[model samples]
Target chain A: MPPETPQPQATVRDVTQILTRTRGLVDPVLRRAVQQLHPHIGEMAGFALGWRELDGTSRVGQNGKGLRPAIVLLAARASGARPEAAVDGAVAIELVHTFSLVHDDIMDGDERRRHRDTVWKAYGVGPAVLTGDTLLALAMDTLAQAGTPQAAAALRRLSSTLLELVRGQAEDVAFESRPWSCPDAVTVEEYQAMAAGKTGALLACAAAVGALLGGGSPSATAAMSRLGRHLGLAFQAVDDLLGIWGDPEVTGKPVFSDLRSGKKTLPIVAALASGGDGASRLASLLGARPDDVTLRRAAGLVRELGGLAYTRERAELHLHEALRLLEAPELERTAAGELAALARFVVDRAH
Target chain B: MPPETPQPQATVRDVTQILTRTRGLVDPVLRRAVQQLHPHIGEMAGFALGWRELDGTSRVGQNGKGLRPAIVLLAARASGARPEAAVDGAVAIELVHTFSLVHDDIMDGDERRRHRDTVWKAYGVGPAVLTGDTLLALAMDTLAQAGTPQAAAALRRLSSTLLELVRGQAEDVAFESRPWSCPDAVTVEEYQAMAAGKTGALLACAAAVGALLGGGSPSATAAMSRLGRHLGLAFQAVDDLLGIWGDPEVTGKPVFSDLRSGKKTLPIVAALASGGDGASRLASLLGARPDDVTLRRAAGLVRELGGLAYTRERAELHLHEALRLLEAPELERTAAGELAALARFVVDRAH
Candidate 1:
C-alpha cells in the first residue's frame, strides 16, 4: 500500500481544487503585474502566459499547471498565513517560470509548447527575449516593492535562483558540444548538479519565499526548502521519463523528443554510464542522428540498459522524501496533504 | 567657451582620475560577486566584462569608461557618505550596464564593441545570453544581500529600471520595423522616450541608488535622479551623433553604423522631419542599401539637412541642464564639481 499523509483523506484538499484556487488567486495579480510592461511587451508576455494569441487577441488556452504557485500558496498556508499574504510570492515565482520557458524555447530552438507555438516561435527571437526580460523584471519589482524584510529575503533568494538558472542552462548548452561517452562527457554527478540548479533552485525558492512571507520561523523555511528541492528532483526525473516515452499529443512535443534532440538527459547519461551491451548499443543509436523509428528503438535500449529503471527509482526516492517531510508536526496538516497530492500529481502528469 | 562651476576649478577632480578611482573601488567587489557564479558562467561573464579572453585566459582589455560607477560613488559622496558606502551600488549599476551590452549585441547581431568581438561573437549566442542573465542576477544579488532598508530602496528602484531598459530596448526594436520617413515613422518625442528608457533609466537609477544607499534624503535622491536623467539624454544625443559621424577607430564601430543598420536614431528622425530636399535625398540613400560611397553621401546629406547641428545643439542643451544641477546646495562642493566635469566629459568624448 502507498504511504499517506497524517491528515484524514476526507479533510484533504484535492490537488485539482487546490490548483484551481491558486490559479484564481495568482492570475489576477500575475496579469496586473504583466500589464505593467510596455503594451507591446505585455502582449508578448500574454501570449507566453497563454492568455492571448500570437496576434494579441484574447484567448483561453493551455496554461502552466501552476505547481510552483500552488507550492507557494500552500507553503504559506501551512506556515499559518492566509494565502492572500503570499499572493505576490506566487505571482513572482510563476512569472519566473514563464520567463524561463520563453528563454529556454529560444535557447533550445523549440517550436511548440502546450500544443501551441512558443513565444519565440510566434514572436521573433528579439521580441521573445524582451518578453522574458520583461517578466523577470516584473518578478523582481513585485517583491521589491512589497517593502518588507520578508519580501527582501524572498527577493534575495529569488535573485540567487536566477543565477542558478543561468548556471544550469550554461551547463546544459556546454553539454551539447562535448562527447557523449568519454571522460569529457557529462557525468551522473554533473547532471545532478545541473538539475539541482536548473530545476531545484526555483522550487526551493518558491516554498521558502512563501514561508518567509507567511512569517514562518527560519527553521520552517529551511524545512520547506528541503522538501521543495526533493520535489524538484522528482519533477525532473519524471520529465526525463516523459521526454522519451510520453505521448506527443499529450506532451506537446515530437514523439521521442529527448532522444530525437539527443539531449543528454538523466536517462541517457545513466544508460551511457551503465557500461554494457545495451549501453553501447544505446550510445551508437544516439550517436547516429536518430530518426523516429531509431529513436523508439533507442528508447527500448535505454530501458533494457537499466537507465529507465534507475531514473524511475531516483524519482520515487525523491518523491518519498518530499512526502515524508509533510509529516512534520509543525505543518498545517491540511495544507501539507495538499502539497503531497500536488507532488504526486506532478510526477504522474502526462506532460 | 564652456561655462564654469561656482567651485574653484582647481578643486574639481579630473574626469579620468575620477573614473580610475571609481574603478579601483568598484571592480574588486564586482569581480568577487561575479566569481560567485558557476565557473563556466563566470568565465563568460569575465569575458563580457573585458577581464579575460574568450578562452578564459586573464587579459586586461578595454573596459567601460566607469562613467556609471563614477556617478554612483560621486552621488554617494555628495550626499555626505563615504564612497565605500556605495561601492555595491556602483558595482550593481556597472553589472547592469554590462548586461545590457551583452544582450544588445546578440539582439542586434552586432559583431564588434570596444575594439573586440562582442560577447555573442566571442562566445556563441547561447553563452552570451546566459552571461547577460548571470550579470543581471549578480547585480540583484549584490544589492539584495546588503539587507538594509537603504539597499532595499535602491534595489526596488533598480528593479524598475530593468523594466525601463527592456521597454527602451523594445521600442528600439520596434523602431527598426516601422517606416523611416513617413508619419508612421518614429517621431522625435518617441525617440526621446525611448532614449530615456534605454539610456536615461540606468543613469537615473545609478545616482538615486547611490543616494539611497548613502542615506541621502528622498528629496536628494530625487534631485540626483533629475540630474542623472538630463545627463543621460546628453549621453544619448552624443552617441547618436557619434553613431553617424564617429570615426571607426575611436567608436570601435563601423563608420555610418546607424545608417548602415537603418537605425532610426534621433538625428535620422529629426533630419527627415525637417521636410526639405536634403531630407528626401537622405531617405532615398538609406532605402537603397547604401554602399561605402552612398553611406558617406548619406552622412553628408544628414549634415546638410541640419541633423548634425541639431544633434550637437541638443547634446549641449542637456549637458548644460545636467551641469546646472550641480549647483544644488545639498551636494558636497568637490563631488558636485566632479559630477559636472564628468557630465561635460561624456558629451565631449569622441567615442
Candidate 2:
C-alpha cells in the first residue's frame, strides 16, 4: 500500500454524502435477501434475529452503518459500472458479514448486540447457529444470480476472505489463553497482521468484488483492494481507541468494554509496553474479571500508561498509508479522491 | 419404485457387486476431499475424526458407512453416467455429512461415536466447532469446482439440506429439554418428517446431484430422489434398532445407547404409547439414568412392549416403498435394482 500522499480534507464530505445516499439505495436489496429464503429458512432466520421478541423487527433489520456494502457499491459505481449490475454482489458481501457477526456473537458468548439480545441469546444457540448457516448458504446462492463471470470472481474473493476471517478468529481465541501484555510493546507489524485478517480482508474483498462487478481491469481491482486494505487497518485502529476511551453515547457500547473483556486491543498493548508504573499495574489486572468500576479504572490505567496516545499515532500512520493507496494513478482522479475521502472519514468518525 | 415388478434376487446381488466396484473407483476422490483443504482445515478435520494425539493419525476414519456418497455414485452409474462424473458430487455430500456429525456431537455432548471420542471430546469444543465450519466451507468450495451449472444446483441442494438438518437438530434438542414429550407423539409420520430432514435430505440431495451430473432426465432424477428418500428412512429405522438391541461386538456402539441418551427413537415412542406394563417400566427407567444392566433390561422391556416389532414393520414398509419407487418406469432398471438391494441391506444388517 502507498504510504505517502498529500492529505485531501475537502473530499471527506463528498464521501459521507455518497455513503449516506448509497445506504438508502441498498435497502431493497437487503430486503430481497431476507425474502428469498425458503419459507422455513426465512422463519428460522427471523426467529434467530429476534423478530418475535424485539419490539418490532427494527433491531435485526438493516440498521447498521452498512459500511461494507457501501464500500462495495461505491467502488463499483466510481468505476462507471451500472449500480443495477452489482447490487446482488454488494448484498452477498453484506450477508456474509452479517452471518459472521451472528455466529461470532455465539462463539464469544456475547448476549447483547446492536443494543439488544444477540441471535443466540434470543433464539437459543441451535436456532441462531442454523440461522447463520442459512445466511451463508444465501450468500453462495446469491452468486449464481450474478450476471457474469464477474460474479464468480467476486464470490471467490468473498470465500477466500471468509477463510481468512475465520483464521483470524482462531488466532484471537488462541491468544486469549496465552500470556500476553500491553499493545505498545508488541511489534506494530503483528498488529497489522491481525487487523488485516480480522478487518482488512472483508474490506479488500468488498472493494475487489465491487471492482469486478463494475468491470474494472484486473490491475484496477488489485489496486482497489490494496486501498481497502489500508483503509480497514485505519478503521480498526480508530475502533480500538473507541473501545476504551470514546464517549458511550457516540459509540453505543459502554466505554472500556474491551478492557472489561480483557481484549488485547492495540492501545492496551501499546500502553502496557510503553508506560512506566501504569504499565506494571495494567499487567497485574490484565485478565482479572473486572466489575464496572474496575473496568473504568482499567481504562484510566491504560490511558495513563500511554495507550491512548500510542493508538492515535498508529491510526494516523495507517490513515496516511490508506490515502497514499487511494491516490494511485491507475484509478480515475474523481474516484480516487472519493475513496481517499472515505478512508479519512473511516478513521475520523466517532462511531 | 417398481414394487410390483420384483426383479430376481440374484440381480440385486450383482448390482451390489457393481456398487462395490464403483466405490473402489471413487476412493481416490474421497482422498482428494480430505487433502484439498489448507493444511489446517485438513488437520482439524482429521483431529475431529479422533486421530489419537499420540503421533499416529488415529483410526476413527473406518467408522462411517460411506452410505451417502455411495448412493450418489450408484445413482450416477445407474444412469449410464460415468462414475468419474459423480466423484466430486459424492465427495461434497460426504464432507457435508461429516460436518454435521462434528457439530451434532457438540450439541448433544456425545462423548463416544463409533466407539471412539467424538470431535468435541478429542479436539475440544472450540476447535471442533471451527472444524465443522471449515468442512462446511470446503463443501461449498468443492461444489464450486464442479465447473458446471450442475455445481450450482448441487450447492443449492447441499445448502438447503444443511438448513433442514439444523432445523431437525433444533427440534431434537428442544424435545430433549421440554417437560413433556414432543407434543405430537413420536408417531410414524413425525418420525418420517424428522428422519427425512435429518437423514434423507442429504441422501436426496446426493441422488439429485448425481442424476444431474449423470445426464439423467429431470423426471428420472426425481424418481431416484424418491428412491433415496425411502432408502434413507429405512436406514434410520435400522440404525434405531441397532442403538437398542444389536450386539455391541457388531454395532460398535454400546447396546441400548439411544435409551441412555433419552433419544425418542421409534421403538421407545411406539412402546410408550402401548397400554402395557412393559411400557410403564421402560418409561420409569427412561426418567432415570440407566446403567448398562438397566439399559439392557430396558431394551427387553421395549421388545416385550412390541416396540421392536413395530420398528421392524415400519422399516419394512419404507423399504418396500423405496423399492416401488425404484421400479418406476422412468428409472434405469439396473440402477434401481442395486438401490433396492442396498435398502434391503440397510434394514436387515446386523450393524
Candidate 3:
C-alpha cells in the first residue's frame, strides 16, 4: 500500500492539513475528467466546477471543500489500501456531488453559492440542468474506466446511491408545499430518512467505494459505510444550525435563509415537536412564508424552545457514533486517527 | 439465435407486426427495472413511463412507441445474437430515451406528450427532473447487471452517447436565444450536427450495443452503428416533415406547433438556406413569434420554396444509405429484411 507515510500525532488541526493534501491529489484528476467531456458540455461543467469563468477564461476559485473526496481517500487509506488506487472513485463521487449541487441550486432558486452566483443564475437553467446531467453520466463513465476488480460493484453502489439522492430531493421539494397540520406532514423520523438519502447515501457510497476499491474486506467496507452515514447526519445537523445562526459572510447565505423559506430542517422540526408556547408561536409564524422579521422571530423562538440545543445534541450523538465506527480493529491506526480528526472538524466548522 | 424465429416475406406491413412483438418483449423488462427503484422514485418513474396514474393507481395507456428498443433487438438478431441476451441493453436504451424526453419536455415547456399531459405538467417540474435523473442512473445499473461479457463496453458507449444527447439539447436551447442575424447563429451544418447528436447518437449506440452483446464481429458492429445513424437521420427528417404538415390527431400535436414555436427544424433550415422570395417571406414570418394564421402561411411558403421536397429527398437518401449498410453479408438475411422494412416504415409513417 505504498508504505504508510510517517505522521505525527493527529489532532483536529491535522484534519485541515490532510484535507488540503487530498484536495491537491484529487483536483487534477477532477479537472482532467471534466475536460474529457464534449467541448460545449466540458466548458459549462468546468465553469460549474469553479475551474473556469463563464466566458471560457481560466479561474482559480473556491471549488467546494472537496469533503466527499477526502472521505473517499481517507477511507481507502484506513483500509490499508493505496490511496492513489481510489482516485477514480474520489473523482466519481465529487462529480456526483457537483451534479446534485447544480441541480439543487436550480430547484431551490438559490442565486448564490460559495459567495458566487449559482450556475443557473450565471449561465441559465437549461445549461445548468444539462451540465448536471452530463456530470452524472461522466461519473459512471469514470468509475467504469477505473479498471478495478470491484468496478462493477462500485458502479452498482454509486448508481443506487444516486437514486436515493434523487428520492431525497423529491421529498424535500414535496415537503415545501405541504402543510404541517396535514396528515402527510413529514415526521421527524421521515425527515431523518430523507436526510440519510439526500446527504448520507452519497457519503456512505464514497466510503464504501473507497474501501472496496482498496481491497478491504467486506466487513471493513461495511463499517466505513456506517461511519460515513453517521458523519453525514452530523454534518447536516451542523449545516442546519448554521443556516439559522451562522454569519452570512461565512456561510454565504442570507441570515435565516432556511427559516425564511420555511425549510423543514432538523432544528425547526425539533422545535415543532417540542410542543409549547415557543413551539406554537414558531408554528404560527412558519405556516405562511416568513419575511425577514418573522424569520428572525422564529429563530429566536426555536432557540428559546431548546431546538438549537436538541439539534446540537443530535449532531454530537452522530459524531460519537461515527468515531466509534472508526474504532474497528481492521482500520489502520494512523488513518483511523485522521478520520476521527475529520469527524470533529465537520461538526466544528463555522460554515 | 432462437432458430431464426420463422421465415416470412418482408413487406412494409411487417414492420408494425415486428415492432408490436418487440414492444411486448421490452415493456415488461422496463416495468420490472422501474419497480426495483426505491418506492418513491419507482412510483414516480412508473407514472412517467405511463405505467400508473399519478396517485399510484394502475393504468394501461400509451407509453412511447418503443422504437429504440426495437432497433436494439432487431440489430442483435441480425447480428446472430440471442435476442433474449440483449434485453437489458434494450431496456437501458429505452430508459435513456425516456430520460431525455422527460427533461426535454420541461425545457421546451411542452405541456403534452403522447396525447396526455407531460410529466412536468402533471407532476411539477421538480419531480419530473428527478424522475429523469433516476431513470438515467437506473439505466446504467440495469446494463451493469446484465452479466454480458460486453457489459463494460456497453456501459461506456451508453454514457458517451448520453453526453452527446445532452450536448445536442444544450445547443438547441442556446439556438433558441440567439438572433439569426448574429454572426454565430446556428447554420445548416450546425443544425445537422445537432440533429445527429440529439437523435442519431442514442440510436447508433442502441444498434452497436445490440451487435456487441450478440457476439457480432467488430466490422459487423460498426456496420450496425452506421445503419442506425442513417436510419436515425431519416427518421428525424420524417419527424420534421410531420411537425410542419401532419395531422394533429395522428401526431398528437397541435397543428403547426413547431412553426408556432419557431423551432429551427430541418425544413425551416432548408427553407432559410434556399434564399429566394418564398424563403424571405418564411424568414420574415419566423422572425417574430407567429400566431396560428402566420404559422399556416409560413408552412405554405416553405412548401412553395421546395423545402418540403428537399426534406423528403434527404430522408430518402438516408434511407438508401441505411439499406446499403444493411446489405453487409454479416447480417442475417431475415433480420436484415425486417430492419429494411422498419427503415421504410420510419420515413413512411404519417405521424
Candidate 4:
C-alpha cells in the first residue's frame, strides 16, 4: 500500500453510473454461468443473487452495490484492456462475494439481509448450504474455464484469497468467545487483521484477477492487489460505522446491530480498548444481557469514547492509500480516475 | 466404458495391500496441505478427517477406505509415472472428498459417521461450515500451486467435478421431497444420473487429475476418467445394498435403513418399476415411515420384486466395465491390475 497521506478528504465523485454500467456488463455473464447449475440449485442461486423472488419469480428491488465487480472491471480497464475482457473475472468475484454472504448469514443465524429474509430463513438450512456451495463452485469454475495460463494465475489468486477469507472469519468468530473487556479483549490490531482477511481478500483477488486477465504486468497485478486490500479495509471500516449508527431503513439492519450480537467489529473493539470510564461502563453493560435502552446507552458510550472518530480516521487513512495506488503511472489514467471515484463512493456509504 | 461382459463375476482380489500403501503415501501429503488452514479450522478439519479425536488427541479407528486417493495414485502409476509424482493430486482429491463428506453430513443432518460424531455434531454448525470451506479452499490451492500447465488441467477437472458433486447432492435432496410412488416417481434413469454425479464425478476427477499430472496423454486421461466413473457407480450400487441388508455392526447403519428413510436407491426404484404386487406393497410401506418390522417386510418385498437382483446386476455391469477399461493398452500392466483389484474391493464392501 502507498504511504498514507493524511490530507483533507476530496469531494468524492458520484460512482453510481460506473457501478450500474459494470453490473450491466457483469450480470449477464454471471447469470449464464449460474445456468450451468442443477435447476434446483440454479433457482436458489438466482434468489441469493437478488435476481429472483423466493417463489422463483423475477424480482426488482434493492440489490448489492456490486462494488467488487466494478473494481474488477475498472482494474482491467486500468491495465488498458477493454472492460469486456475481464467480465468473466468480474462474474467470478461477484459469485464469491455472494457465496460468502450466504454462508456468513447461516453462520451468524441472521434472518434478514438487504431487507429480505435470508436464504436459510426462506429455503431452510440444507438448501441454503447447497446454494452457497453452488455459488462458490461456479466462482472457481468460471476462472478455470476462462482460458489458460492467465486463468492459472487467477485461480492461484482466488484459492489463496479463499484461505485468507476463512482465516479472517475464523478469527472473527474466535473473537466473540473472548472477554468483552480487559486483557483478553479483541485489540485494534486484531480487528484490523480480521477485517483485512474477511473483507480485504476477495477485493484483492478481484483486482488481481482482473488485471491479470486484462494482461497487466506482474508488477501491476501485485500493485492492484495491494490497492484492493487497502480499499477493502476502508470499506470495512465504513461498514463498522453503519453497523452502529446508520438508519435501519437505509442500511437494512437494526441500529446497534453489532452490539446486540457482541460482534467484535472495529468501532466496538476500538472503544473498548480505550481504557476509559465509558469503556468500563460499556463493558459492564455488554457483560449483561442489555435491553434496547441499554443498547442505546452502549452505542452512545462507544461514540463518546472516540470509537466513531477513530474508525472514520482509519477508513480515511486506508482510502487515501488506496487512491494513491490508483495513481501509479503504469495504469491507464481515465480508468484509474474512475476507480478512485469508486473507492471514495465505498467509504462515503457510511454517511 | 467397455461393453459389459456378463460372464461370472471373478473372485474379487484382496486390495488391502494396495489401499494401505496408497494411504501411507497420501495421508502425509493431505496432512501437510491441511496444515495451511487457520489453527482453529485445522483442528476441526483434523477431527473431520479422523486424524484426531474431538479433544485434538491423535486417534486410531476404522478410517475411510482411502478409496479415492488410492485410485489417484494408482492411476498415476498406470500412466507410467511414479506414484510419488501424483501425491499432490492424490492429496487434492482426498481433501475434496473430505470436504464433500463434511458438507453432506451437515446437509443430511447425519449425526454419526464411521461410528464417530459428525463434524457438525462435534463442533457447532457454524464451525463445521467453516471447516468444510477451509478444506475445500486447501484442495483448490493444492492443485493451483502444484505446477504449471498440468496444474491448470487438474484445476479445470476439479472445478467441473465440484459442480457435478453439488448437482448430485442437490438432486439427492430434491428426491426426498419427491413422492415414494407415482407416475412422477424418481425413475431409474434419474437415480442413475444422480448417482453418477454424487459419486462418480470426484472419482472421475481423481483418476483424470492423477493421469494428467503424471503426464498421461489426453486420450489416456479420458479413458481413466470413464473407468473411474464406472467404478464409482458400482461403488454406489453396493452402498445401496448395504443401506438395506448389510449387518448393522459392519455397516454402521441399521438394517433396512434405505426402506426406513424411503431412499430411492437402485434396488427400490427398479423393484417399484416392476409394477408387481410386491412392488405395490413395498411402495405403500415406504409411503409411511416404516418401523423396524415394517421396514423388514418392505425390504423383503423389494427382494421379492427383483430389486436386489436388479441392483446387483447393475453393480456387476459397471464393475465389469471398469475392470475392462483397466485392460486398455495405454495403461501400465501391474498398476492396472491393482486398479482392477481396487474396483472389485469397492464393490465387495457390501459383502
- C-alpha TM-scores of all predictions: 0.95, 0.81, 0.91, 0.96
lDDT of each residue in A1-351, candidate 4, tens digit only:
997754323424347778789989998888888887889888888888998988777986456888899999899999999999888889989999999999999898888888889999999888888898889999999999876677778888998899999999999889879998888899999899999999999888899988988889999999999999999999999999998898899878887888887787888889999996888898998887968999998899899988999999999999999999988988999899888888888888886
User: How far off is residue B128 in model 3, in Å?
Assistant: 1.7
Better of 1 and 3 by DockQ: 1
Off by over 4 Å in 3: A1-13, A38-40, A53-58, A181-184, A276-278, B1-12, B38-44, B52-61, B181-185, B276-278
**Candidate 3 vs candidate 4, DockQ winner:** 4
Off by over 4 Å in 4: A1-13, B1-14
Q: State which candidate, 1 or 4, has the greater DockQ.
A: 4
Alpha-carbon RMSD to native, per candidate? 3.2, 6.0, 4.9, 4.4
If the candidates were sorted by their DockQ against the true structure, best first, what order would they fall in? 4, 1, 3, 2
Candidate 3 lDDT (Cα, 0 to 1): 0.83
Best by lDDT: 4
Task: Please give the lDDT score at residue B11 for candidate 3.
Answer: 48
Clashing pairs in 4: none
- lDDT by residue (tens digit), candidate 3, B84-193: 86888999999999899888988888887777788889877767778888899889888877655687677877877887788788778777876543355467788889
Compose the digit string of candidate 2's lDDT tens values, residues A212-254.
9999888888977887787787788898998887776666666
| Candidate 1 Cα outliers beyond 4 Å, as residue runs | A1-13, B1-13
Question: What's the TM for model 2?
Answer: 0.81
Query: Which prediction has more favorable lDDT, 1 or 3?
Result: 1
Clashing pairs in 3: none
Candidate 2: fraction of native contacts reproduced: 0.06
Question: What is the lDDT, from 0 to 100, of the residue B126 in candidate 1?
Answer: 61
